[model samples]
Target: MMNNKKPEVWLRGELPGISTLLQPAAHALLQSKEEVFKYTEGFPEFLLWKRPAGRASVGFHLQHITGVLDRMLTYAEEQQLSEKQFEYLRNEGAEIPEIKIDHLTQAFTEKVAQAIDIFKNTAEEKLTQKRTVGRKQLPSSLIGLYFHAAEHSQRHIGQMLVTISVLRNQNN
Candidate 1:
């Protein structure tokens, strides 16, 4: 066996356009994207919305991670969530008819790409600027929002993986 697997994104050296300060966040987001695709590969669509032990379903996790990235990045840019974003947030985990595993995974992939682009455009100075989150307008720094988005994605990825494993085992 060749045993060939690439190191996690952070260990692969700095991404070209992402600032050093934002590298960890970027790396985490990229790693989350990779893991989402890897773990969800060939996962049966029938189990996508199945929840065991009242925990969130794999479908919800996928939708949530993507939605959080969008909302968090928007806050990082010192903006409020748009109507569409709010609607997406409200719908995060709701089962949809005929949704496939790949559809959810691809949406997450695209959201991660968009997040990276935002990271590249964000100047280092802006990272420390004040920002507000949600309608409550609670205080946070720009960097805080970005980092939260990354870590939040990682959190959901872990939950999603566990859900997937349990679901598969149950079906078997």
Candidate 2:
């Protein structure tokens, strides 16, 4: 007989207990994986869809999600993002140049790994620090960064999925 065990859900809907500072990061990391899987599943070959009418391909969007996570991680660490990162957001492409589908997937994976490490290693005191993005500023608490990363990925993942569907239909 085949084993039929189901995968356990990785995140909780309710807020974490007051004692845990890293829970938000943990939650966001899980959500990121879900988003990545949703966007990339069914047709890996479809990642090649770069529309003449659109800005970037599905691969570029994948790279962008990781790129934004890296920015949020910088904010979590109380470090201002560099001009290069700002340029990436404004320009809308890979921060790490010459990115292919494999490279984007790797970058996204690395971002998640870094996120987990930061959450695990950071002191509670550091989590309460302030972070700024140009004129807008917010506390660097785990919740803030966690929601930021997750919500940002959610928005982009939706875009990518829709784009993938359109591209797949167009190509066929």
Winning model by TM-score: 1
Clashes of each: 0, 0
Best of the candidates, lDDT: 1
TM-scores for every candidate against the unseen true structure: 0.97, 0.70
As a whole number from 0 to 100, the lDDT of residue 66 in candidate 1 is: 92
Quote the lDDT for 12 in model 2.
47
lDDT of each: 0.92, 0.66
TM-score of 1: 0.97
Writing each residue's lDDT as its tens digit, candidate 1 over 4-116 gives 99999899999999899999999999999999989998898889989899999999999999999989988877789899998998888899967778888899899999999
Q: Once superposed on the true structure, which residue ranges of model 2 sit more than 4 Å away at CA?
A: 1-8, 11-21, 34-38, 41-49, 52-56, 94-98, 124-126, 135-142
Q: How well does candidate 2 score on lDDT at residue 50?
A: 71
